[model samples]
Every structure is written in structure tokens, then in C-alpha cells.
Target chain A: MMTDYRLTSLAKSLPDTVPFVGPETQERARSRLFDARLGANENVFGPSPTAVRAMAETQHWMYGDPESFELREALADHNGITPDMIVVGEGIDALLGYLVRIMVAPGDAVVTSDGAYPTFNYHVAGYGGVLHKVPYRYDDHEDAVALFKRAAKVDAKLVYLANPDNPMGTALSGAEIVEALEYLPDGTLLVLDEAYLECATQNIALPLPLDDPRVIRLRTFSKAYGLAGARVGYAMGAPGLIRAFEKVRNHFGMNRAAQAGALAALEDQTWLRSVQARIAASRNRIAEIARKNGLRTLPSHTNFVTIDCGSGPEFAKAVLNEIVARGVFIRMPFVAPQNRCIRISCGRPAQLDILTEVIPLALRAAELR
Target chain B: MMTDYRLTSLAKSLPDTVPFVGPETQERARSRLFDARLGANENVFGPSPTAVRAMAETQHWMYGDPESFELREALADHNGITPDMIVVGEGIDALLGYLVRIMVAPGDAVVTSDGAYPTFNYHVAGYGGVLHKVPYRYDDHEDAVALFKRAAKVDAKLVYLANPDNPMGTALSGAEIVEALEYLPDGTLLVLDEAYLECATQNIALPLPLDDPRVIRLRTFSKAYGLAGARVGYAMGAPGLIRAFEKVRNHFGMNRAAQAGALAALEDQTWLRSVQARIAASRNRIAEIARKNGLRTLPSHTNFVTIDCGSGPEFAKAVLNEIVARGVFIRMPFVAPQNRCIRISCGRPAQLDILTEVIPLALRAAELR
Candidate 1:
């Protein structure tokens, strides 16, 4: 029950579970440092040196351009869109929350994958929207058609899909996604989260028409650009829909340091390419380690790899605990079947080397226990 | 007129006007440099030098500690409260927005001053809350009892009051606030915005019980701490109420650089005191400027001064525009009577010198025009 302050029934009904815990929280709880910090899929390669330098240089300003004119212009130039067609925010997390606030309301129907990013769902719940979740495909890819069908059936106001899915490390082809769009019911907006887009295989570009009124594509500096802490992201859509963000967004919400860092990171595409190369190598090393330990590694098109532990939830939990106990921080999916797999992120050579050495010991410990 | 998205009827109806346009936006529009940036009430002295150094040192991390453990622990120690009772976020603006999101829903009643901070009103409108605005007292104090009476009449769910208030630079003693608390009707939450608390006189502190479930105090690093660009702030209230933020807050929204900077800024209280001294000096200088121009200046408890331009809104607007054209940026209150007074922030000696030199010239130009 809520206090006498009179919170809405929806807020009073929502549980207090956080979307994701940072590795720092885990370290604090464990009272020791993780030997391999590969959780939360953060790019351990670090942000571009130039971006870091720029943030450092501009640390004295009160606030950045409320319009985010410079960063928006740069993003538009990079994406071949008009500056007015974009809005910059703290991160895609914040943008997701705002989009829900702009669109969904009490009793409105929203659709998403069953085990998708919980933060988006949290926003929907906060707005009192009813969520209809579709299960992932048996092969682990997001079932785009199923999502569209669900949205149509519920007359959903919004439908969320993360291409190059998380937790399972699977992806839907751009063409596959476009084909599903035909099934999208009228007046249903589609949210295409492309957070891991840059790190995915080059063939996955759907290039949703910018003029399409029903689609908004979210891209961020957090993942491949390695600037999650800076919290900068953007969404592209028809100018009309995008402008609605102005009606409610905190005009000066964009931190000056974040805008400077993101601009520099975007310009240094060379660093991004290098990080991609390193991430690819780290993924392979993880898969090799899993194979050596007699586990089945799911084929991945993103920075992280998920390996089937060849056991039940209890066994997978045991294996994960053993690794974490051994000072290797990693995570697993929260849902059934998917929870039977362990997820590891791409990092530097030293981090992967530690993971390579620890997986076998963890497996053996789990078996013995 | 919302597109296919199902916005709350209230959200669909909210007006798009924000509190103020950022100085950066003005700079972009004018395509020229403002010699004096006295707008936005930002400290021209910037943040503590120590904060600048700290942010520069830690700009490359992926994400900060999600729990904000160290900062909260330090803040709790400083405030004589437990860390669990504090919730840190991007800034007081973000915190106010979050508080509104949790407490107010479509058609929910909320109350504030007619000419109070527009940002809070903007948040209320965005969430579809019905806003009940009480006019400012003739003496320029926020009429606390009148606000309570209005809230009671409307059965308001939340009421906002900023002590050492913005725009007016006036304050109510803690005793006064606590006394007003008694008039707050049952089921009403009081939002005590103490953004300028540290800089206020000794009389501002009231030994009110923190466990009184009716009130939540908002604090920030934006004003006296001079880290507005960093976007770090916190809310102090009963643990039960504070815990509710976990239900919908962006779990990883706090910036790593900002966290580090705020921690260092908190640690260097000696530097903070020095900034306070400088602010006091600047405030006096602003008053002198007003006096020399034959304008009446209010007694200010915050970092800015409200100078009555001895004219109507049109004259105030003319002087303001003339100052802007003369390359000194400042602002005025949005409503009548209050609009007769232009607000000027405390700045460095150089910035103050510019304001001193420009006020007379701008007034003369306005008179001639």
C-alpha cells in the first residue's frame, strides 16, 4: 500500500525490482573484486581517448545547449537526416521512459518480447500501460511476426523489439524485420532498439525509411562506443513524432560533458572499428573456452556470447555461482530455458584470458558440488 | 492530436513551453558570444576546482556505481541520516520530475505558486495532473498557508514550495516551513525544494522530524556546489518513500564523471565555503548595481538578486532585451508584478563588472527606444 501521499493505483501496484544491477553492486555485495568484469555487456575496451579528453576539457560549464544543436546536427550529418528529426537524452533508458510517457497511458496495451530489457517494461508499467509479452523463438531470435500479431490483437499503442537481441545473443535479419512490419496494425508505433547495431554483422541494416510514421529507431553511445557512463543516446523518426519529445523532455537534461564526449566518440570512427575488432576476437575466445569446457555456445552476432550449460536451472545457477565465487563476474538470463545459459561480455585480452582459465574450474566445481 | 500512440488524455493536452531556454540556445540563435552569462542563475565561478580535476580523472569508465554507494554514504554522514533515506539522481530537475511521476496521475490534483518554477509545473502537466496555482504573496514570499488552503480545497495530492526560492531569491525559515506543515491536509505530500539551502542564513534550519511522512526535501549540486553541468542531485525523505523511486527510476542513469565529481566536491568543504564567500560578495555587488541604477533590490538569501526595475513588464522586457543585445544575458519572472523585477545571478568579478557597466547603458537605450 502507498503512503497517505496518494500515489496512483498503478504506482502502488508496481514491484520495486530494478531493471539491471551494475557490476559495482555485485562487487560490493560479494565484498571482493571480480577478476573478469564481463557483466552487463559493457564494452571493457573503454571509451575513445579523444572523447575522454573532450569531457575532461569542458568540465567547467554550467549546462550544454538545451537544443543539443551541435550534437543533434552532428548526429543528423552522420545519419543523413535533418537535425530537427533527432533528440538527445541522458541515454536510451531515459529516451525509452520518455517515449512511453509520450505515448502510453493507463489501460493502454503495449507489446514486447517476454524476456526483453526490463527497463522498457518498467517505463510501460510506470505509465499504467498493460503489457503483452510474446515469447522468443525456439532458436532464440526475437519473433518479430509474433510481436506484430500481438500488437495487432491487443491494439497495442507501442511494440518494442531489440534487433540483435540481448541475453540470448541472437539476431533477426533486417529483411526479416521488414517483412514483419506488414503485420503491424495501424496506429501501433514500433520501437526498434539498435543498441548493439554497430557491433553486429554488417548485413543487418534494415534502414527503416525515415519517413515511416510508425517507427522510431534508438541508437546509443553506451555499447559499441563505450560511453555508457556518459549517458548519451538519440532516436530517429518522422519529424512530427520526434518533435513531440520537445513538449516534455528536460530542455537542459543533456549534460555538457556527455554531449562533448559523444560528439568526439562519433567522430573517431577509427576507435569504434578497433573496438569492434577486439570484441569479435573476445567473443571467439569465449566460445572456444565454452567448447573446451564441454558446453554448447550459441552463435552470436553481437559483443556477448551465451553458452548452454547443458543442465537445469539449479545446475546453471551453481555454475554461475562458482564462477562468481572464483572472482569472475558474469550473468545469466532471468527467464526459464534461457536461464539455463550463461552470458559473458567482450573485453580486453586479459579479461578473456581470466574467463578462459576460470570456466573449466567453475564447471568442475559445479559438477562436484 | 497525438499520433497512433495512446498518450494519457492529460499528457496529450499539456502545453509545450519549458521553464527557460538555455543560454547555449540563445548563443546559437544569435550566432554571437555573450560577454556576460548572468542567465540561468549559474555560478560564473564554476564548480570547485577539485570537482573539475576529479571528473577529468575518471571520464573513461563505462558506468558509475549504480547504487551511488559512496556518495550517499558520505551525504548521509554529513546530513546525520542513513544512506537508505537518500536517493541521488541527475539533478533536482530530474528528481522533481521523478517525484511527480510517482505521485501524480491523470486528473490528480497538484498545487504550486502561480509564478513558481515552471519545470515542476511542466512535469505536472506532462503526467496529466491538474495544477492548482496560488498567487505569490504581496510581500513576495511564497504564501505557504494559502497554498495549503488551496490544496485542501482541491484535495491536492502534492504541493511544491522552494525555500530560498528561485526567481525571487527569497526564503522561509525552517520553523516557518514546519509550522506550515500543520496546515497541509491529510494525504497531501509536500515537496520542499531546498536547492539553495546551504547558502541560506542560519535561521533556515528547522529541527523537523524526518520521519514525518508528509514531506520530502530536494537538494542539488547544481546551485551552490556549482556542478550544474554534471547533473547530480538527491532527495531526502522517509526510507519507505525513498524506496519507491526504485520502482521506476532509470537504474543506471547517474553519470560516472558526475558521481566522482560530486563526491570530490562534497569532500572539499573548505573549497565550498570559499565559493560561498565569493557568492556573498557577488550578491552584494549585484545589490549595489541595482542601488546605483535607482532600482529597488529585494533582500536575497540565494545566489541571485531580484531587482525591481521600477516599471511594468514591457519596460522590464525592454531592459532585458537591450541587455541581451548588449551581450549580457539575464532573465525575469514570467508572471505580472514579479515580472517587474529582473533576476540576476552571482558571477565572477569580471562578469559582475560587465553587468555593472551594462545596466545603465541598457536602461538608457531602452528609455530612448
Candidate 2:
């Protein structure tokens, strides 16, 4: 007789599907590397040379300071907040998982935009939370008002809103989000993910007080700082909520070299400015390429552009598949109406040249299919 | 009115205590750094130069291959097992958290030895698992038979055992552990933590079949491999049990450079052997110092030694405090019997010289107090 492992009902109930299949997995399946990698919105511009040097020079034989005191202090100073208000972790993805575990018990309600970041939904499901998704607006922006209203209806303990939203590259202004807060239920805590805040064209920092218990904001080094491989991200919130992470977090989880890298990266504002400029230029180049292919592009407040394939979800998926087949990697939103578009991350001029060369061909092939 | 951010009942119930207060925290509290850093069982000889170079040379821009395919494949080849049977994470701490989350639900029973690794207990409590702890044997080894018997009696879903145990620096042979397995109940799973295996003088790798569903063994790059700061560890188990980690793990949580560093470290068998020799020499030196100071040192099979203070827990703690004040960092066990001894990690020659100078003074101060 076989031994029964006896996994928890929640674990057993979880589907085998992951939120996003990595480009590396796809490359392995196809047995070829992508010539122009743009699918995941990674900053190809890379981290500051100073940051790279710091990581290389770190004493990696020692465990990272479990409290991540130095990095948290640096982040606090950079954000104009006290160190107690910040909690650093492996990444925004891991932070989301921790937050979901803390807030959502079995059968608890959590709210998110239907086609927003799927990783948040994955965490909710992993924790046995019942997710209630509100659809994106017709303009392809996350409907914050609708999300808050639904949270009220569902009595959700948590509501997720990504400013400068992913998948569609659209965003709501800070004032607009603040106005939407009125609709949020009294007990629901809003998770405002600003992973791409540094990459946005406009200053999108919310004007809410730092001690506001109604919301917690997440930030990452993976975007404009170009240290995604370092796996460093942080949550800024009320001191009480931030202190709660201490109860269950893997205290020594931070990589020493990554912490050093992030600290150095945060100090290099010149590098950040240059990367932001490059991203702006690349976004326009991608839009130009989409226009030449007779496709419309969504106005972006992020590092990626969402191109309307001018048809249904099938057509958009075909376009993505064709691009992947041609050694250019990209992704599309999963849910419909938004699924009629494909998302393309900003890249260097050389990578953009490949995108320029491949778009029309991919479109033709996708249309034929 | 203040906003009510509702945390789950489990989250609210969790205590503020952490698994281990990092040595850095101590240094900060003292407003001075330790002259000899021997507290945490971190390999002071450091990771291989080749590993360091590999990390420095890695691409920090790209997010690590979320599947960690190359590293996993390398690990599989090294262990003489298929890649599917392993799951890599940020560290053993995170992996343990994920494992406990999968097998344990609120009020589920888990078993571990009293005065075993607190991190495992922390994970159990984090998930609301009811932990049943059996006392350590008088010989200072983890009482494996007692643990299994308790697991069976409590109908535990999981039982944790660390060979060449921490805080005590004692060991039971692989054969002894295999023999003790007979006491384990049919449905109970064993978590065999081998974090210090590479540091052990004996070949303690369990001889059981690799596909045994009853056991999952965790290994780390943090000890003899000296990549504790890199935060890399892997779990080996039956394929079905390993596959379940996918349902909840942070797939993209690895630092890219850490993966590169660990792969390079694994390939450098010469560096590992050299570190092993150093650890052995350091252990003998530590025992010699303890003997000179009129204290009894436990026979160690690990990178650290536990020295009996020739008195009670209070005396041992006073000795630890004096050592810290004297700028030679060291620790002691938290629970009774074991708490009568102080633990010290193997250090470099210069560091050991500092320890030699500090130990006598610390003992005198402790006795005087």
C-alpha cells in the first residue's frame, strides 16, 4: 500500500497551473533562446555599475542581517519615512504571499482587478481565500471604484490595486485613487502595488499620510533599478502592520549581496534617470512599430506598451505565439477585452530593431492562422 | 475613526518573538562589532573564490530563471536523483515554511525534539500547527525514537529531526536514524534537516531509498559551502511530495547571482574538502580551549562545539554574555539541560586567537558573577 502524504485540503485543492510560465521554461520547451526578451517587463538597461560592484564585493559567507537593518534604513531615508514603517523581503511577489497569508484565512474574501497581476490572485488561492475580481474599465485601466464597491459587497479583508497597472500599462492618478478610497469598506485594507512607480512618466506617489492604516504600499528594485535578479522588494505601511510581518516572515531570507546591491542602486539617482529616459524612448519606439503594423497602442504610464491587435483574444494570442516562435518573447493579458491586446516591455535600440523587424511578419502570420 | 485592518485570527494570535535574533542585532545593541564572529555556525573560511567570481559575473538585470532549471539539474546530477524530486528555495527556512504550510492546517499536530531548531517550531506556530515536542536524550542527541513515538501517539502530520543537531553539536548515525524510523506512524512524514551535513566528519547521509514518501531531506549552501549570505537551499524527497511545493512556493524568489554562486560552489569539491579540514581543526582547537578552561566539550560531528559550563543555565548564559561583551560573539541553547552548554562556531585562526584570549576572562567574569 502506498503511503498517504495527507496534504492539507487547501493544498490539495490548488490547481497545478502557475500564475505565469517563465520565458526560460518556454525557451527550454522550444529548445531555443529568445533573441529579444521583452515579455516580463524586465529592465534590460541593468543595475548601476556601482550596485554591481557592491554585490560583487559583499561578504556572502555571512548570513544577511535578518532584520535587513541597513537596507531598510536606506529605503526609509529614500522614501522619507521611519525605518519601522518598512519591511524588506525577497521580492514583491513574496511580500504579496506574506500579506495574503496574514490577512486572508480560509473562505475569506479578497478583491482584485480581473486581469491585473495574477500573482496576487495565486497567493489568495494558495491561502484558501475566496477572490472577488472586478473587471478593468473600457479604457483598459483598473476600475478602483468598482473594486472598492465589490470589496464592500464581499466584506473583503483585502483589496489589491496596482497603480500604473500591469498587463495594460494604464494607471489612475493619485487624486483619482484617493477619491475611490471613499467607496472602500471600513475594515478592508488596500494593497497598493507601485512596482513600476519609478518607471512612470508622472510622479504617481499617493498623497495619503504614511501612517494611514487603510493601505499598504509595495515597491520593488526589479523595475527601474534593474535588479530583478537580486530579488529585493519592500513594503511600506503603518508601523503596526509592518511590525506584524516579524511574526511569520523568514527573518534571514534576504541575500546579503542583493541587499548591498539595492542599497547602492538606491543611491544612484543618475543611473535611475538615464534608465527612465531609455524606457521612455523604447516605449515610443514600440508604439511606432505597432502603428506601422496598423495596430493601436494603449497610452502607458509604465515601462511597457499594450498593443491592440484590433481583433479578438484568439488573434492577440496568435500574435504572441508567432512572436515567440520567431525568437521574440512577449505576453498578453489573460482575460478578455484586454486579451485583444499584447503587452511588450521596453528594450534597448538593438532589441527594438528586432521588434521592429518582427511585428509586421508576426501580424501577417497571426492573421493567416 | 481609525481604520480597522483585519488580520486573520491566526495572524493576530502569533507572538512577536522571532526564531533567532541575528548577531548584527546584538552588535547594534552593544554599539560595537564582535572581534570573533563564531556564533551562528556560519562557515568562516568562506565560499570558494570561483563561486564568488561566478556571482560577481552573473547578470543582475534578468530575473532568475523562475524554474531554476540549470541549478536544479546540476543539483540533481550531484545527488544522483532526478530533477523533479528536488525543490530549491531562498533557503531551508523558506522551504520549511512552505512545507509546513502544505502539510499542516490549523490545529494539525507536528512533532519535533525539545531544544531543536527554533525556526522549524516558528514555522509550525506560524501555520497554527499544534507542536508536540519530545525532550532531547541525556546524551545530547535528538531522541529520534521518542520523536517518532510521540508523532505516532499524537497522529502528527510531520516530524522534524536534525542530524548533528544545532545548539548541542551531537549526532546519531544514519543507521541509527533508519532504525528509529520503525517507530514512525504510517501517515507521518519525516523532515530530515541536513543543513550541517557537509560540515559533519562522518558520512551521515541516510541510506533509505530516494523515493521513500515518508521522508524529505533538506540541504543548504549556507554551511560548509559558505553561501549563507546568498540564501540558497534545496529539498530532496519523493517526486509527489516535491511537486506539491509548486502549489505554494514563491517561484521567482531566487537571487540570480546566488544560483550561479551555488552551482559554482558545488563543482568545487576541493574547496569543500579544504573547508572540512579547517572545520575539523577548528573543532579540536575549540575543545582544547574548553578543556584548558576546566569546561567539558561535547564530542562534536559538526562545525561547532557545545561546551558544558560545569554549572547551570544561568552560569552558561553569564559566560555567553561576558563573551559577547568581550567582543567574541557566541551563543547558548534556549532550553534546559542543553542550556547548560554554550555553542561556538568554527572560525579562522585569527578569530580563534581572539576567542582564546576572551574565553578565560569570560569564564572568570561568569564565575565571579
Candidate 3:
């Protein structure tokens, strides 16, 4: 007899596709490791040595504090808010998934920039929520006002805005975001992903009240703090909204060492400042490389720089493929005008040296193609 | 105007309460740390030194492989299955949540023992699944046959069974489980949680076909391997069922160091064997302590022992409170008949000495109350 493992309609409806394939997957497929792992926007400067030692010294036999009490307390202090205002999770990805689960019912509308974070869209779609996308602004920043207007039109439950946005690597100032918040509908919650905020050159933090119910800001240790492998990120919002996470979150999901690592990373401001300097220097190096190759680089507010390939998506795709073939891992945006650009993460000087050697040759190969 | 976050009806319905309160929270409330950390059934023997070193040496800057390819391959080899048949997740709790989300739509039927893992029940309720509970057998073993029968009656999409059970610390043999499987309905999936299987003395491993679509077996490094803080667990099932996890799982969720730690933990079977020996000895010591205190202990197959308090839930609760007041952290079952017993985890020799010193005093206090 045939056994029926009855998957829910929503589960069956979701496509069996991941939002982003890891570079390691490509390495296995190609049977060779990349010389420069500059694709995933990982901080090449690494986490604080103090944080690494902290993780190493943690007691691994016991379960992490399910409440993540100590880590949340540190995050609150770092952000100048009370512990009740924060909810920590595996990362921004998992946090986004939880937020979507809490707010989006099947057939509910959610709004985001057309080419912003695909992971957010993946979460929205996973929950059977309808997505209404607004195009980016002419300057390549997320058009938050347009997104808010669309949210109002669709009566969307959530509107996602990634300040210092991914893929395009351009950002709107904090003042610009505050001005745009006026257009958001009263019922809509803004999921402001500040994942790259620490690396940005100007308007470093969003100036919103800690108790603002209309917005939930996300921050991560993955980029500037350089603890991506630790899988630590947190959401700062109204205490009531933060408390609601207790209803659905995996209480013991956190890795204990990660909590210790993040707390130490947060406390070590010197390491953060050093990493920021390195990121800035590397961003300039990438822009210099792009200029030498006769390609224009977008003004990046993130650890990665997006370069205009002087052609369409197909040419940029060829360039990316050629770069990968030459053993320097890099990626490109997935949609329309954004797809016309190839994004390169800021890397260590040695990794950037490899990128410097490969890009011109890759461009030449793309031109021939 | 009142701001509305527009949480889904389901979200609003869920109680803002966590399933298990961490010992740290209690410590905060009491303003003192427990002298002996025996609650939560954590393996006090700790993880392999190799596993701890592996995690400490891992690159903390890069994201863990989204596929968790290396660890999955290691797990597959260890389990005598192909990689496609496995899915690694944050922990069993998170995996159960994902399974419930996949199988149970709103109002769909699910089955479990009435006082089984509260986290599973929490997931079912969070997903809006209607649960049909079966009672344990008189000997305190999970009633698998009765659960399958109830699943058939309710047309449950899923049924959860934790072999080598929690709270009661009792288990059915693998042969008995196989015998009971015949009663399971064709459409219902069985979630066989074998978290404490490594510590059990008899019927140590489940005897089931790897390709069995009717069952998904969950294994964790948190207990015997002693890596609870790492939050690593794997599910083994038919390839199709395992692949379905890709549709909704946070692909980038695994902590890199955790993946390394679990992999090393899996390789060190010598460390695992030593831990199992320690657990067995600790269990015997705990049982002896209860017997000396004029209390009977349940036959335990897990890392914890359940002691009959010789009264009702109230007396057991008072005993537990008194024990806590004396600076020993321990827990008890949450339901009737079972609640008449207090649960104590297998602790180190030093920790058990403290338990020996404290139990009589605690019992006397409870008797006076």
C-alpha cells in the first residue's frame, strides 16, 4: 500500500529552492576551492580575539539559557534600551522567518523593495503571504516611501526595508528613513533590517524611539562584529512585540558559545573600530579595481561593493561566471536593473589582490562572449 | 490613532509564554545560583575534548555551509544512510516546529501523549493544529499502539513519540516499538524522537528501514555526546521527506563552530561510550539516594530518574520547591500521576553528594508543609 505523508497545502506549494546557495556548495560542484572567497559579504577581518576565547571557554555540556538572558541583557545595554525591547535569534534570517510567521497569515499582503533581501521574500512566501514589490529609487537605495505607499494600498501587514541595502550596497540616511515612516499605514509594521548599519559611512544608526510599535529594527553580529558563523542577530522593538516572540520561538535554539561570543564581541569596541577601518579600506580597493577595469562602482555603504558592468544582466552573469571559473568567488543581483551589476564583498588585502588579478581577465572573457 | 501591528489571528491567539523556563531565570529570581546544576537532563560528563577544540578552532568569520554538507555526510556514514535521507537543524524543538508547519495546516489533527514533550505541544498549538492526546501505559511507557489508534480515529497528520522518554524516564524496547508500528495509519507520519537513546542500556538503537516514509527518526548530540549548548540535531527519513525541509528551513541557520563540534563529537565514539557509562552510574546513585530517603524510583532508561514522592503532585511540588530553596536545581513532571514524581538528572559525583545531603531535608520540609 502507498503511504501518504500528508504535507500541508502551503508546504506543497512552496518551491524546493534555497534563497542563496553557499560558496561551499559551488566549491563541491566545481571540485575546487575559490582563491578569494569574496562573494557572501562575510567580514574578512574576523571577530574579536576576546570573543573567540569566550566561545572556546564556554561550558558545552549544558543547554544555553533558553531565554538568552545574558546576551539579550548585553544587547539592550549596547543599544541603550531595556532587555525587554530585544529578541535574539539564530540570525537575521531566522528572526525574519519568525517575524513573518507572527504577522503574516495565508493570503495576507507584505511589501518590500523589488530586489531587496530575497530571504525576507522567501519567508513571506513560505507563510503563503502575497508580496507586493516596489522598485528601488533611481539612486539604487531602497525606496521606503514607495514601499509604505504600496503597503497602504494593499493593506499589507508588514513592509521590509533594508537600510544600507544588500545587492545594491546603497543606503538612505536615517533622516530619510524617518521622513518616509510618515507615509507608512497605521496598521503596517516596518521591518527595518539594519544588518549593514555598523559598516555604513554616514547616518550610522536609525534614530527611532525604543518603544515605537510601528517599527522593528534588526541588527547582526555577522558583518561588522564578524561573528557570522556564530549565528547571532537580534530584533529591537516594543516590549509587547518582543514578548510575543515567546509564543512561537525555539526557546533553546541558541548555541551557548554563540551567546558568549556575541556578548564579548559587543563589549570589544576596539575590535569593531579596527574592522570598520579595514572594511572602509577594502571598499576603496574594490572601487579602485573596478575603475581600472573601466567599470563604475556604486557608492557602497556596506562591506560589499556593487559594480555596474556597463552592459545588461547577461554580460554581468558571464563576468560573474568567468570570475568564479578563475577561482575568485563573487555574485550578482538576481533581478532586472539590479542584475546588471556584479557585487563583490570587501576582502582582506591578499584576497583583494586575487580579485584585482582576476577581474580584468574575467571582463575580457565576458566581452568575447 | 492607535498603532496596529496587525498580527495574524493565529499569532494573537497564542499565549505569550515559553515552554521551559531556563534555570538561569530562576537563579535571577532567587538571587542565587544553584549549587548543583542537575535540572534539564544535561550530560554533566561534557563533550569530547576534541569536539570542544574543533569548535574553538573553527573560522568564526564565514557562514556555516548552508547545506551543512560535511556534518550530514558524516551523519549519513555513521547511520548507514545516504546524505539525502538526513536533515540537520538547530535542535529537535526547532525541527519539530518545522515538521508541524509542514504537515499540519490550521485545524489539522496531530497526536501525542498528554504529558509528553511540552515543546511539541507548543509547536502544534502555535501552528493552530488540534491535538489529540493519548495517556501513558500504567508502567509509564508511552502508549504507541493507543496513540496510533487515536491517530487513525482523528485522522492525525502526525504523531510524536519520544523513545526513552522524558520526565517518566521509561522506555519500550525497539522490538515493542516495531510491533506497535503495525497499528499506525497509512496517512499519519510518526516522529520518533530518540534524543536519549544513546544513554539507554537496552534496545539502544531503533530497528527500522532507512527509507521508511512512515517514520522520521530524530537524534541529537545534546545528551550522550554532551553538546547541548551547540544546538545540533538531525532527522533521518525518506529522501523526499528530508528534501522537503529545504523548502522552509533557514538555509544559513547552522552555526559553523557547532557544525564542527557535532562532527567531531560524532567521530569520537570512545567519548560517547565513556559518557554513557557515567550516566548509568549516576542513574544508579540517584536511585539509591531516593531508596535511602524512603522513596521508590521509576525504572529509568534516560539520563534522569523519576522518584515517587509517596504522595500526590502537591507533596512532590513542595519537595521540589524545598530542594530549589536549598540551592539544588531540579524539575518534575507537569501532569497528574506523573506529577506525583520528581525528576532528577544524572549529575557528577560531587553534585550527587550535594543531592544526597539535600533530599532528606527537602522531604522533611515537604512533609511538614
Per-residue lDDT, model 1, residue B31, is: 94
Model 3 pairs in collision:
none
Judge candidate 2 at residue A96 and give its lDDT: 94
Candidate 1 per-residue lDDT over residues A107-203, each given as its tens digit: 8999999888888988999888999999988887889999999999999999999877887878888889899999999889999898898988666
Candidate 3, B1-369: lDDT as tens digits: 222557789999999988888999999999998999988999999999999999999999999999999999999999888999999999898888888988899999999997899999999999999999898898888999999999999999999999899878898888888898899998999999999989888874668887788899998989999999999999999988988888899899999999999999999999999988999999999999999999999998899998999898899999999998999999985587688889999999999999999999999999999
- CAPRI class assigned to model 1: medium
**Alpha-carbon deviation at A129 in model 2, angstroms:** 0.7
Estimate, for each residue in A1-369, the C-alpha lDDT of model 2 and write its tens digit: 222678899999997566788999999999999999999999999999999999999999999999999999999988888999999999999999999988999999999998889999999999999999898998888999999999999999999999989978888899999999999989899999999998888987888987688999999999999999999999999998998888888999999999999999999999999999999999999999998889999988888999999999999999999988899999885698788999999999999999888888999999898
Q: Show the colliding residue pairs in model 2.
A: none
lDDT value for model 2: 0.91
Where model 3 places Cα greater than 4 Å from the true spot, the runs are A1-3, B1-3
Interface Cα RMSD in Å, per prediction: 2.4, 1.6, 1.7
Tell me the tens digit of each residue's lDDT in model 2 across B1-369. 332458899998998677788999999998999898899999999999999999999989999988889889999999899998889999999999999999999999999988899999999999999999999997888999999999999999999999878878888899999999999999899999999988888898899977688899999999999999999999999888888899999989999999999999999999999999999999999999999999999988888999999888889899999998999888885598788889999999899898899999999999899
lDDT of 1 at A4: 52
Give per-residue CA lDDT, model 3, range A55-103, as digits (tens): 9999999899888888898888887899999999999999999999999
- The models' CA-based lDDT, in order, is 0.85, 0.91, 0.91
Model 3 DockQ class: medium
lDDT for A128 (candidate 1): 82
